[model samples]
Target: MTSKHSLRNPKDMQYAFSYFYYLIHKKVPFDLDKLWAKEIDINRDGYLNENELRTLAINVFSTPLKPTTFKEFKSDLYKTCMELRHPTPAPVIVEESSSSDSSDSSSSSSESSEDSGSTAAVPVIPATQTATATAVATATATVTATTAPKATTPAVDNNTLEVGQKELEACRIDLEVLKASNKTLMEIHKSYAKRTMYRTSIEGTDEVAFLMVDDNDNSTQTKLDGVRQRRHKFICLNDNINHDKPTAHLVIKVIHDFYESLFPFPSSFELPPGQTNHFRYIHEIIDKKQEENNKNNTFIYIFGVVGVMIVMLMWKRSKRSSNGNHHSINGIIGGVGNKSAAKQRSNKRYMIV
Candidate 1:
C-alpha cells in the first residue's frame, strides 16, 4: 500500500477500488463502451470516487449474479484495496461544497462534468454495535457516524444508543433521499411525456404530422385526415439508447418527428392503453428534459446539505477503525424482512454481539 510516488490518479485509484467493489459487491455492466464510461472519470483530467460513479453494472444488470462471481471480486479485492490504500481513514464529511471547485476547474458544462454531486452514502450499521463498544470508542464513533437522536434503552450505554439512533436515522434519511431522487426523476419523465401531448382544436395546419390531416375545426365532427406519405410510428424500447434515461427525451423527440412525417394532417394515431399518446408524449419529453436540467441545479443544492452527513460518516468510520471497533452483519438481526420495528430494534441491539 505504500508507494513513494502518488498514483497518477488517487481518485482513479479510488475509482478502481470502487469499481472493484462493484465487481465484488455489486453487478457490472456488459457493454464495453458503457462499462468504460461508468468506470473512468473523464472529469478533472482523470478519475472519480464512488458516489459520482454511475454503476454500469446497475444499468445493464437485470437479474441476480451467480455466486461464483464473488470469488473473482474477492480475488481482486485485496489488490484493489492495496492500490486504493485500503481501510484508509474515511474523510471528514464536508457539509458545504463550494463550486469554487479547485478539483474540476477546467471541465465542461454541468452535464458533461463528472461532478454529479453524488457522494457515497455510507451504509447503515446496525445499532447493537454502538452498545457493545466502550464509552471512549462509542463517543468517537458517534462523531464519525453523525446525526441527532436519543437513547432507547436504560441498561445499555445511553450515549451509544443515542449515537446509534443518529446514524440509523441518518441512514433512513438517506434512503428517503435516494428514493426522492428516483421519484423526482420518474416524475419528470412522466411530466415530460405528458407535456409532449398536443391536443388542440387547430384550424389544422401544422406540417409536422406524419399523416396529412384534413380536419375542419369549424365542423360539428371534424374528420382529422393524416398526410398521405407518413412513416411508421417510432418504436421506443426497440432501439438501443446510448446514454441513460437522459436520452429518453431525445428518443421521444425522434418519435415525434416520425409521427409528424407519417401523419400528414390532423389525424390522431391510435395508441394502446398505458402507452404513449403521440402528442402528449412528445410534449412531456421536452418539458421533462428542462426539468432534468433544473434538477442538476437543485442536485447541487440538495447535495450541499447532505455533504456534511457524508463527510461525518467517513470521519466517524475512520475514528471507529482507529479504536479497533469491528462490526459486520449476522443472523442475530432475525430473518431478512418482515421483522417488526420493535423486533428490528431488539435485533439491532445485538448486531455487535
Candidate 2:
C-alpha cells in the first residue's frame, strides 16, 4: 500500500516493491556490498548515508521519494542484505612453531652434554678408542638432529592459505551467480521502465480526492462540501449502500440530487421531459416486449382451447355415426332371419299334407 504523501507513483511503487521483495527472499541478484558501493555509497567512503541512497533512488526510478519512504526503504534494504550475507569464519589458531622448536633444541642440548661427559672419562688405549668413536657418533647424531626440518610458521601459513583459497573459491562462485542474476534484473528493469512511464507528480501534493460514503452515514454532505472546497482536479465518490434496505431508494435520490447539483447543465445526449428517458429506455423496451409476449401467450391459449373443442366435437360425431351403422347392420340381419323362419314353417305344413 502506498500513501499519497509518500511514493504515490504506481510505477515507482511497483518497482520498489519488486526490489524489496527480492531482498527479503535473498534473491537480490547483485552483491549487496558491491551494489551499495557502486550505486549508493557516494564519495567511496564505504558507508551509505541518507543522501546517497536518496540520490540513487531518484536517478534509478526517475522520481523523487518522500523522506519517510526513503528511510523505510533504506532500513529494509539494510536488514535484508545483512541477513543474506555470510559471516566470515574465524581463523584457526595453530599452536606456536617456536614452542616445538624450543623443545627440539632442549633435547639436542641434553644429548650433547651426555656425549661431552663420555669424552671426559680417563684414557685407556682401547677404552680411549671406544670412547672417541662413541663421542664422534653422538656429536654427528646431535648435528643431524639440530639441522633437521622443524615445524615453522611458513608451514602453518600454508595450511591457512589452503583454507582461505577454498573459501575464496566458494565466494567467487556465489559472486558469479549473483552477477548473472543482477544482469537479468537490470535487463528486466530497463525493458519494463521503457514500456511503462512513471508519474512525475510532486510528493505530498495530490490533485485528486477519493471519497466513500455509506448509506447510514449522516455526514455525506459534509464530505462532499469538503471535496468541493478543495477544488481538486478530479474527484471520485463511492457509495456503500445496502440495496435490501427500505431506505435504499432515498439514498439513491440523495445521490442523484448530489450529481444534479454538481452538473446541472444539459448535454446533447439527454432528452427533454415527456420524451423517452434514455436512461430508463432499456427498461421501457423490456416491459413492452413482456406485454407483447403476454398477449401472444393469451392468443395461443385461446387457439389451443378452440382446437381441443373442435377435436372433441369431431370425436363425438364419429362415435354417433358408428352407432347408427351398427344398428342398421343388426336390423338387416333380423329381417333375413325372419324370412328364413317363415319358409321353414311353410315346408313343414307341406310335409304334413
Candidate 3:
C-alpha cells in the first residue's frame, strides 16, 4: 500500500492493485512468464519493457492501461527491485563514508607501499631526529591497523556479487523455460481456435472434421455424403441456411434423414420423438402468427379504403341536396310574380270598358 515510488496517476495505482490481487488470490492455472513471452514480447526480445508490459496487462491480465499508468507501473517495479536488492533501513543512519570503502582504500595504500619496498630498514639517526622518527613510526602503525580489515572487506564484496550474479542467471534460466512452455500452450490454443481438422495433444491424438453446408445449396447432399464416408472421430454438421427460404422445409427434411441414417437406433436415455418436437412446434407457431399478422394488415388496409369512399359519398350527397333546394325556391318566386302580372292586366281591361 505505501510505496516510495511517486505515481502521479490514480489509474496506475489501480492497475498495480489489480495485478497484485491476481498474484495474491488467483488459483487458476496460468503461466505468467510464458504468457509474457508469447503475447507481450512482440519483438522477441527477452526483456519486458514498458510497451511489452502494457501488452501483457491488456492481453493476459485483461487490464487496460493508459500510458501514464504503464509508466507508473514501470517505476513501481523498479522501486520494488531496488527495495528487494537493498531494503530500506528502519532507522536511517547517515554516514560520511562507509567503513568498507575506507578499508579498501587503506589496503590499496598498503599494497602500494609494499610494492615500493616499504619493508626496507630505517637508517640509524641522531637524537635530534628521534622525535620525527617516533611520529613516522606511529603513523605506520595506524595505517597497518586500517589496512588489516581491507582484505576481508573485498572478499566479502566479491562473494556477494558472485552470489547475486548466480541467482540472477538461475532466474533467467527459469524464465526462459517458462516462456518456452507458454509458447507451446499458446500454439495449442491457437490450433484449437482455428478448428483444425486433426489435432494432436500432449496426452493423446485425435481426428476431427467440420462441415458447414448451406441447406439450400445443391451441393448440400454431396457434402453430407462425404462427411458420412469420412467417419472421423468427431464430426460437426452446421446447418447454414435462410430460415424463410422456400426450400427450408425440404432441406430440413434431408438433414433430418442424414442424421437418422447415421444414428438409426435411439439411446436408452433419449427423449421420445414427440417430446423432442418442441422446436418444430415453436416454428409452426411462429409461422401461424406471421400468417395472422399478414391477414390483419390486409383487413386494416381494406377497411381504411372503404372508410375513405364512404366519406366522399356522404360529402357529395350533402352538396347535391343544397343545390336542389336553392333552384326550387327560385322557381316559386318567379311563379308568384307571374300571377301578380295577370291580376294587373285584368284591372286594366275593366277601366277601358
TM-score of each: 0.14, 0.24, 0.26
Model 1: per-residue Cα lDDT over 1-353, one tens digit each: 22344434343445445554544444222332332343433343233233222231122222363434322222232223222332234347533223223223222333343354455443433345333333444455566467422333212221212222333233322212322344333432343333222333323334333222212222211211222333223221223334355545655555455457555465455555478644446778788888999999999989987998899999999998866633333444444554677687888889967
Candidate 2 residue-wise lDDT, 164-222, digit = tens = 23332333222223234443346335533443223333334377678877775456767
| Model 2 poorest ten-residue lDDT run | 153-162
Model 2 bad stretches (over 4 Å):
1-280
Worst 10 residues of 3 by lDDT: 153-162
Q: How many backbone overlaps does candidate 1 show?
A: 45
Candidate 3: where are CA atoms >4 Å away? 1-92, 97-279
Q: Model 3, 104: alpha-carbon shift in Å?
A: 14
CA lDDT scores, all candidates in order? 0.39, 0.58, 0.57
Candidate 3: residue 323 Cα off by (Å):
0.7
- Kindly list the per-residue Cα lDDT of model 3 for residues 244-349, writing each as its tens digit: 8888877777777778988999999788877853444578979888999999999999999999999999999999999999999999999999999999999999
